[model samples]
Target: MTTAAPDLAAETRDALDADVAALRRGATLWTRLSLDQRATLLESIHASTSAVMAEWADVAATSKGLPPGHPLRGEEWLTGPYMTLVSTEWLARTLRTLAGGGNPLDGVRMDETAAGRLRAHVFPGDLSDRLIVSGFTGEVWFDRDVTMARARAAAGLGQRTPDRSGGIGLVLGAGNITSIPVADVLYELFASNRVSLLKVNPTQDTLVPVFERALAPLIEMGLLRIVTGGGDVGAYLTRHDEIDHVHITGSAQTFDAIVWGVGEDGAARKASGRPLLTTPITAELGGVSPIIVVPGDWSEADLAFQAEHVATMRLQNSGHNCVAGQILILSEDWPQREAFMDHVRRAVAATPSREVWYPRAAKRLDALRDAHPEASWSDDGRRAVIPFDGGAADNLEVVEQFAPVLGVTALPGLGQDFLDTAIAYADERLTGTLGANILIDPVAQTRLGDGFERALERLRYGTIAVNAWTAVGFLTPALPWGAYPGGTLDDAPSGIGVVHNALLLDRIDRAVVRGPFRPFPRSLTALRPASRGAFSLLPKPPWFTTARTGASVSAGLTRYRAGGGLLRLIPTMLNAFRA
Candidate 1:
């Protein structure tokens, strides 16, 4: 006899229920497994992922409108496989420390500043970190209140407590970054000590197979299950009694909808202090991230170098990154302000535009332009430069355009005074406290002296990078990536909690990252040399909007991912040189 056709809603509910049950079953084994068992499984997972990175990246790239073997496609490799592998390696190191060292900081070195703040030097922690990205440095700045004793006691708080047989976590994956769900699943499993029922985002349904292949080891262990559906499945899983917790990476609005209800009902539920979903939730949400370029006696070269750097932030991935600089805080009083702006305009115009692959991106871009038509560069319609003159500052600062739109807001002042005003602007005006960057030339740094140090202290952000994009903070597995803590279910500006924290610190205030004032070869700052500087320092990155040789870059990156060490490095370098 043939079975009756399954009802769509009923089937979704039943399927999600089974997924939760499987996760619960998988978690039971996790609770009883020793630390050694967890470490060994992670090692196995590492091997599984490493084995299929090239194939996984190729498939993922193709899904994102980037053709296979295209140079720009390497962006997929870096964000997808490279980042996942790095996160896995970091967790493995932590597991070893937790199991073998007895102390989480056994092999790690941490120091306290005179101000009584604990600082853990994370970047360039080893030879590989030093070799791959030279001169890049970052540190975890523990909250000022966290005393040394607390820092030590809370290093591995998750481990300090006995397992309460934690249940399943429903991970609502992000549609943008393909690696987010993979990392989220692993983080839930190893970091938070929970089994995961990962619901793939509808936007990236094509990547489910790659995820399955990479996570086969975890899946077979019954510790993880990947599910796919639309809102019905997500809603069922979110409110299901079996799910002990929910973790999501999306907008703050989505977080509210899941926690409360939607529209006036959500507002009423939030006001009444009663949420539909009782399970605890942690999230990593987007923010209107700012980049404050401190005014200084910058040379023509400095202005050119920073212009390309800034453009790369806004144009990378068609400017879909949550960490991309949303507002450009420039100094009105600086003599080079106009000159620097010229370079910015030139750079943005010169950079090759990519297709708006994101859903509703075109509409969003149109809304931003409609909201403010006095744009400096909006002729292309896709990419724009919104100038925030004195009167229009409010609209520019508050609104976060997710598309390739740049908003420039000029503050009046110079030196520490300018930096102080910019800091205040970010703290009071900006909506979220996710990530912010300060691009201060060494000349400016030296001029400001102790004032520069003070400005760093006052910037209220989860991560404050000097002369670097905030994305570096997000990509660094050792660094905790999240908003500044202290967000409630009622109001989560940048969301709460952190991910990719290898050390497993119980508390973190922010991460301070510093990059070189100038990239490898000074002349290469403008991207295309205007008859000056060095000829070629290194190959152009695939994500650079100006990149013309994506196909070759893709091939070299594939070879590099396929255990092609120095042998592959030479060809990649040559390809970069050619680009």
Candidate 2:
């Protein structure tokens, strides 16, 4: 079976060139939208997303081998239309604040790091956030060189002074997470002050129309455009004369291919500093994310709770997440080490089998399996894990497995000694400086005290989450998500720049998010039965394999987005525990 070659006619290049020119012209008009106008447009978008997710989820679910209205439909809704609507809501608030003579961080807490970075504790924005994600907090850290005064003043630069001569920017969207492309577009449109041309990935190309409908205001105002095609179209756009800058979300290999060319030619081009594409690039590339569990004396319940937490982090999106904990580091000397491992195995075994939805995931899985013949294929035959008894230095330590396969490596130490060793292992051995997570008992945290805080400060990842997966850092619309900000264009380890920053801080370095070790719903150690009742606010995250909620949480969420209130929330919560 021979595949046909891609169409690369001169006419196609000419058409794209003309489109780019038009978008470049439109860029000047895009910034003309007043802050109020922009907010109104975003509000319209938020309204439209309610309708868009219905069609979007159907296509996404069919492709992934799930029924259109199945529980798994929640994944697309949450990551797609639901997320875009949330971003629009936040951005509108931000723009409104900037429109007035007010700062967005009116009541947000702030503290100076010993390392000279100004950390803004941005989460728990309101009472709702506090009640919903109780004990969950997130902070955004500015670059070391940035001053407190400057950081505050730098927020909302795009809205303060619109770019009259803004240029068209290209976004090479990721196929995995639906919200990612929309997030990148928002960053370009509102934060970076550019007219965005979002190139939908071929795998999820069907969603372009849904996106067009969701972002209708932007499209109508000539602030955005969505195009479809394969690598040929992407290559054309990357090299197009009118594309002033670009942002991509994908693998580092793909980044290299875009910046340089392919094969030996690409190598020579990179070395000679004469690449085919000259447009400045900012990307979010995949990394070998690490999760470090501080050794602690734990009750049986503690082990089980943390085990499910870790398992959920891996199983989300079938481990296709770029920041999913690919490598889990534990303390060999911990008394509960064996027990925790047993619980982890049990938790994963309980997780139902899922289809390999992400493209090329099966191939990546096979490679990892072939690479590590000793990988344990636990029950359900759903997930596989490779036990790493070897030292810190190994292939498993450096490479990212974009599949439902993880590598577990344990080290010998206690307290800060264990933390220091674990941090160093991840900082050095992990492939890229994207994001990492740390799980420490509160007692251990207090014992480590300043040492623990300092250890977290020293961690070099772009985003660090304490007692939670790093996704929370990314999900917080105000916190910036990207590689730590100091990499060069020639060699960006996890790509460059930041996105999802509603405040629009000029010099964001990284984000830090902290969650309670045991939150509601999964309160494995909660003594009071009433403490567990807080789970009624929302259904268990339907993305979790263990969430067997028979009711369509996705539809309920959509209705809620379109204004369902407590009427819809009641059924959603009741149905969530059925699993």
Candidate 3:
């Protein structure tokens, strides 16, 4: 099987260049547009995309080598248009508030009466209150001073300073998730008043058309641009003389390379306390995300649901995601370890072998197996569920495997032992800190609350999700997503800073917390429904017959169209949450 080199045609290049120029112009106009005008345009874009959800999903699925009605196809349906609509709506409302000269953060009061004395409270019925309150843990607060400062700076630029009117921004898009780069560009243009040049990842060229169409409103408005190619293209745009600021979602290696330049000369320059080039770049990099399995008396349904949840985290986008749960930290003495592992293995084996998107995934899995030959293997390369017996945790396989592979390490003893072991493993190994997933029951939360909190505090990861996968944190626009805060130039594992939903925040670099959800249900886990007619409407649902999948999907989507709003959104959100 020979793979052909990518063809970068002159026509494509010209289109990309035109789009870039359009975006550059759009950015200027976007800044000048009254926030209400911008909000109106955003609404139009959302409405347009929503109207053609199935078409967009088909295109996205076809590009990814999936059938027109694959479950992953629904990703574009749910995450792409749905997310765009939700995010755009939120941004539009936020912009309206900004335009009204009313700070969205105004209702959240914070005071420091004395040194080291901090008090924060939210006014009832405020958007800020509704926005920050997490369904998982109730209320979430940020450093109000830092958030206000950034908001003021962003707001003041247009009003107080004429020179800061057109801020040039460079957006480096993520290769995996289709919506990230698009959302990043939108945020820069609308949320922060920055003119953006979007650099598409080499791996995600298929999404270029979708973005082009979805963001046409912004392009017509003269506020956003889309550019494509590989390293040369990225470097050219990032180092372009016109770009004022940069934002990227990729690996820490990529981030470091951009910031310090690459190779020996770059290293020397970095060591000399002089960056090869000076451009402020914000990044949301990868992490050695861990899933902590607390000791619990889980039911069969619980085990099955969790297995599917864990599997979904790995299998989504073929495990190329930055927020994928890579590690499973469990208690060896826990009676459910064997049962959990069994359930996980069944889930992995049940899932079809998806097309591995990342080039080096096979190599990474091979390396991991070499380090631990006893590791289990499925006939299909899509699954690797390896559990370690009681032993040392200092191996390459234990450290990382960039594939649909999971490393299971068992900690001896009870509550403190489990917490200490997880912390030690995270501290000793793990590569990045984009986010972590922790599965804990109410019993464990109560028994190990202090220890788990302390462990969370000690853990190096950025976003921590208790009892759930960190992917939820990424999907939910309410939370900030990035590297763990407080990391410096010396230590880059956790990377630096934060992105996403920090609409008004600046100082926050990391978020660590837990989620409270009922134990998983079997209906959410199984691929096949017991009844034929029940889920026949879902195209390519685990149970769908490939030949008739199209009709089923059409029927289901028709139902969705007929009964729109909360009725449709509720089930979709539930499915996404379970996934």
Candidate 4:
């Protein structure tokens, strides 16, 4: 009779009070199910996350060190479980188009953005996203006081009405993308009809048993739970009192220690705005993104393919991506600015030195090499590259050296007055409005026509991309990822609302995206060389980090997006033509 080993902090407070009383009775049975039972419970959670997505990309590439068949372990199977089965197959095709009454933006395509706002045209979104990423494109843009019949009666999940009162949220995930806590637990259970719990993020505690066997149909219909401990179990489930809301992805110093209250009483409750948690939080956090580039008349293979596309937008995950691309800007009277920075230092020394895997990443790359002590280091002090020059760009444009550091700088004027002073120096010197990347050169955007969409509507950033990589709007689930929407809760900056939208859109303002600066058969050399135009077969981008068969074409495009037909696109087009 040796039954006394159960006191581990009273069995973790009785298993977090029975998982918050089974998510407060599964938040009114997950808002009374419907919408075709939440599209057959997200198609049984996309067939249990496509049958354990190769053991969740082999335990997230062996917890970041990437062991088995590591060609950057195809960035842990395209950012984990193939972006959680592409956000559970686009929010179960927008809950089977609102349970067949239609209007998941019925036949999509809309227009109107010279900044008047209202765009739409979301990705190819058909003919299998134009045969898999062929000349990619996407758009969304809305909030200029969204119209068109209030963006069609506020698209998706019928913008909540009739007493379907959702409640128990909490999430707080993201420990460096293993599908950001299964896309923030399928956006708090099928786009905010709540009933979640998630937690996880103790650097992804081995993906909490592969997210409880891939979200066992929303934790066997108690809606969801999936806990894990650390930071006092996320400060006792963020002051748990049957938690009503709180999103969080991570870091704005943990969203001000969960809305003020840690050291020195969270700096006197964030300087007296008094918030020890009123429980209505939402965040995404992290900044210093920028990439810019816009000069013109390029080609030494377009400056070695956009300097390996700006070293795969700052060495992909090794830059601990919060929309990576940590500053590169450029222009300083562009005469191929030092030959496109000598092919961005040979594309950040030909990509492959990884594993400084997040947590204190070598003491933040040794405090960014003690504030750029003549930067350029690599032989495993884990890549640097700095540059700056111009009052050394105010400490890497407001510190966000997540690691694998890039920096660069420049800025002056040329075409369209250098893309309007690099879009007002990335909207008043970049820190983070989430994402931004520009590149240009499709004949310098047809010689800055309409000053290249008024420099993408004067870039404020919440997914910009163009010539692609705001981590492709965080692996596109019909794009909407956060920030640039008047952030608050005491100066949020890059920590506000929005998440993998999947057409449950409401007021959203950004998400542009575009691609094919060159890559397939060198993008058919922009359709028969000798100048600029563009076409696409779209290769070389299995999320590039010098992609040579980025781990068998991101594990054969995650079993051809978890359906595996047409012979899994003949081994993902023969491993993306061997990258």
Candidate 5:
């Protein structure tokens, strides 16, 4: 009575061809559908995906070698399915508005501040409306608008076509986060008017079924396809003759390989001013994210909250995440460094150790420790928590670890020196700028606003969070998640381009600075007993006093789910008001 599963390779190939063919049929048929129809499709997708939430959690946990019903599993579930649904719904509505001939750029005035920066004041319910939807940073301006045109012209680019029409796109997905590929495809198709052929990473091959089911609406509509396997499949799809554009969310190594091709021939070609191939490839690569803890943070609650924030950033996905805060930069003369380290150590000790899933994670950890023997190790070697002493510059711990580990370094003095040291370390030592977490008190932030902003400006990282973990920006759908501006073929930090939240279709290329009033309660930053409990209880948290409050807050996010804005806002407002 049960049907056998189809051959995955064959199905994937067929799906890819079908999706491309459908997109080649032109945008008229796809664009002609009413906004309500698109919303309905998205709603259906969400509903179907929600039904299998528990199954998805189980698969993630089993694959990662975690105990049954682990808290980290619940964290992944909330992030992958639950948060994705909310983002999709919000974007669907935004698309509906755009399709109705509502000028997305209405009320947004653009001003060019400098050579690389453009400041825009977007009106409510406009194309840039979603910029302020959540905790996202950066301004939004329509590429075709007069202001943007002027800005582009000022930047010395000649008259370029402002074709708003969408086209076919190929999405190369990251294996770390389950929803990245899905979110990227959604951004390209619905938000940017393009059909997508998603190339899944080998690490996430097992989740193909879940993806297929979640994307059934697009699959049925022939607008999206999910393909699996390895390098051969990715190269085949990326080099497809019919492909119009490409977007990848992975490592810089992978991005460079794609752009210049691999091996000695490719390197020679790149050096000779001729790439092995020429294709318009955009990407969001990895980073050794930094967390800056300001000097004047005192209260026990503040310490606890900040410690948890740092731990969660590292522990999430076993530090396989590109946005994980690997470096903790603190002021050595602050006098609270010892207390902070003590709290942080306690938090890490309390966190339950889970096996890292990324290939060669153990080797990478070993390499890091060998390079920096002083680095502290957990009893099981599954985790490393290295705390740097104040007076050492030649220590190995100052180097990048790039594993399920954290390196705590202290910079003496405050004011400009602190800012300068932090920026210098990030620019010179860190591997990438995909994410950064900076913690500053209100007084310090206000007094050092100019210096702090300057430091943020100097930071090469893509997403910089203030007084909160980088994960907040990662979870917030409104942010254009990617690297900083002016990243070229020569320098690939912060990778290239943006993804997440299909609503605004923003073409931003810089830092997203998130300023939270206080550290998030029940944050997964630094590992702690509360975090362990939060992760365990996340799949199904009690309505009250749950550690996975974000998931609970997310559960009632949609206006449709709640009767309207008033109802949906109530829960979020309550959290904010309480905070």
Candidate 6:
């Protein structure tokens, strides 16, 4: 039996080695192809991806315990196939521009923030985007030094140089989301100009067949390879000689395990700043995301809508998302603080109970419950809300509870004062810097004016979603998603680098995504009368866990995006209206 084990290990090593070698060879061929050819390849991928959307979403939903009739099943379609399809189409458009010898961001609106940071308005690319998400907007904020000329020069694949050499890139996929791996692979191939070998997390390996079908164009060209295995296989590929660069979407511990050794050896290596692996790496590690609520004179409808919004931020995908809101920071002096808390509880209770599908979810929840014995929980124990005062809740502040758990804490002051303190606390206390959200009344924001933007500047996070969940930044392919810069190998908090940046901009500081403060009809009345353009036809987003018609709406939106044309949105709009 021992001999057989060695033989099997040897066989696995040989297969992985062969795959890496193939990617190396494909990388060279990939570089030799013209921009036009690459664009054509991406178009083929989009068509192929569309063909597998239904089956792909189904497999993902079933594996995550959201069956066909399940209320949260819409999450599967939106997060899985819909996101992948939309991103593919957008990327194809960018590639075509490069192929046509035109700058991808040629006509893109560029502006500067209060602190002189360059920002590129990426979303609402056309009428379709404006119609699809309505008032939703996305912007990519570049580093302070990245000027307009420099950004223009550096944007797009092979824009500065028509021809470029490429290498083999290994992507370590996240287990929680099916679209993450697919999107990572696409970013590597299209954005970085590298042939990729995707190592899928074993927990979601059931989607391997679907991935193989969707990405068949790249697979057949040897530009991409997908493999599924446990940590041993990941460790093997991370250290493999043929792999030139690596990208991962998982936890900090996993990143540490790869860069350093495990256990005492790993600790010693980390302390000494001597890493085991020398390969260049980029990561999107999970963090304890914060939701900072600024004091405001909110109407009854606004309170109820924002409450559901907070619930959606925390409970989406059953809180399996890395960008899920883990901490709720409220102003102690805010008159509506208690009222908002009550509304949040009711919204959470109204949402259906979802399975805790991720591994060790119960153990993590138990740990949080043990830390805060005063925490409140749902009947099924799948959800919990732990309340703490001031900054005494160190346990909740520092821990990245990757489950349906929320830690609510209040700080002193109101308005700008409260915003300043909340921003400072989140920056200093939160475990990671991946993403954060701020909910403020639109009118209150106008009153605060520059103070609000300054607060945004002060908050140290990669993505800041104002009145929207940070997942919006993730779902949008145009935004660069990762940690704030300056993370070293030894002291990396949320890992390093960004992915899914379709425009391929360099030196991105962060992404700021804004959504309407209210849903659809409510949004029209909720916004200031002067800013009518900020209203959207979008009702409650189909991905919301509480949406009654999520499944049908999400499926319809996918078909509409996958080339079903404007006619496809007819039924989709109908389903959305029902939602």
- Per-candidate TM equals 0.91, 0.92, 0.79, 0.35, 0.78, 0.96
lDDT of 4 at 317: 78
lDDT of each structure? Answer: 0.76, 0.76, 0.60, 0.80, 0.62, 0.84
Candidate 3, residue 519: the lDDT equals 27
Q: Write the per-residue lDDT of candidate 3 for residues 65-183, one digit (tens) a residue.
A: 67854545554454455556656655665567777877655565554322222223321223322222222331123343544465445532232322244477888988777778877
How well is each residue in 429-525 modelled by candidate 5, as lDDT tens digits? 7677677777776556667756766676676666667654566566656556777655666567656667663435444544354444343343233
For candidate 4, write residues 1-579 as lDDT tens digits: 011222347678678878889878877776677777777888788888889999888888888887886678888888888888878888888777777777778888888976578888878787666666777888888888888779878787433451365688888788988888778767766666787888888878987888898889888888888888777777777777777888988778778877886799889988989988888988989788888888888879878888988998988878887888888889889988999888888888888876887888789788778877988877466888888765634767876777788988787888888778877887887776888888887877876666588668878888898888888778888888988888898888688878888888888888888888887776775766554455777667778788788788788878788887776587687768768
- Model 3 bad stretches (over 4 Å): 1-27, 105-163, 388-400, 449-455, 487-490, 512-563, 567-579
Q: Comparing candidate 1 with candidate 6, which one achieves the higher TM-score?
A: 6
Any runs in candidate 5 off by more than 4 Å, and if so which? 1-19, 26-28, 31-40, 105-166, 387-402, 501-579
lDDT per residue as tens, model 6, 1-579: 111112237778888878878877787788778777777887887898899999998999899888678888878888888889878877878877877777878889999998889999998788777776777899999988999999888888543453565588899999998899989998877767778999999988899999999999999988888888888788888877778899999988888988997999999998898998888998888888999998989888888888888888888888888999989999889899999999988888788877988999889988877877888788388888889875454767776778998889999998889999999999988889999999887777887887889889988899999988889889888888899887777766887988888888888999999988778887776556645225768778776777888888888888888888787678788778777
**Predicted candidate 2 versus true structure: per-residue lDDT over 1-579, tens digit per residue:** 002223577777666666676677678786677888888888888887776777876777676666654555566666677667667777888888887777776677888876657889888676545543456678888877787788778888677787454488999999888889999998988877788888999877878878888888778777787888889888878877678889999988889898888899999999998876777889999688888999877778768877877877787777788878888898988888888888887877776556877887788777777777888775444477778775646776777777877789988899999999999988877788999999987667768877888888889999999987888777778788999777665677788888898777787878988876654455443344433112222224454556665326645655565555665666655564454
Could you tell me how far off, in angstroms, the CA of residue 144 lies in candidate 4 after the best superposition?
35
Looking at candidate 4, the ten consecutive residues that score lowest on lDDT are 1-10
Clashing pairs in 3: 23-224, 23-225, 25-222, 26-222, 26-223, 27-223, 287-432, 287-433, 438-467
Is 2 or 5 the stronger prediction by TM-score?
A: 2
The per-prediction CA RMSD against the true structure, in angstroms, equals 4.8, 4.0, 7.8, 21.6, 7.9, 2.5
Candidate 2 local accuracy as lDDT? 0.76
Error of 4 at 335 (Å): 4.6
Which ranking of candidates, highest TM-score first?
6, 2, 1, 3, 5, 4
- In terms of TM-score, which candidate is strongest? 6
Prediction-by-prediction clash tally: 4, 0, 9, 3, 14, 0
Candidate 3 residue 480 C-alpha distance from true site, Å: 1.1
- Per-residue accuracy of model 1 over 204-260 as CA lDDT, tens digit each: 888888888888889998888988888766776777777888999988888988889
What does candidate 1 score on TM?
0.91
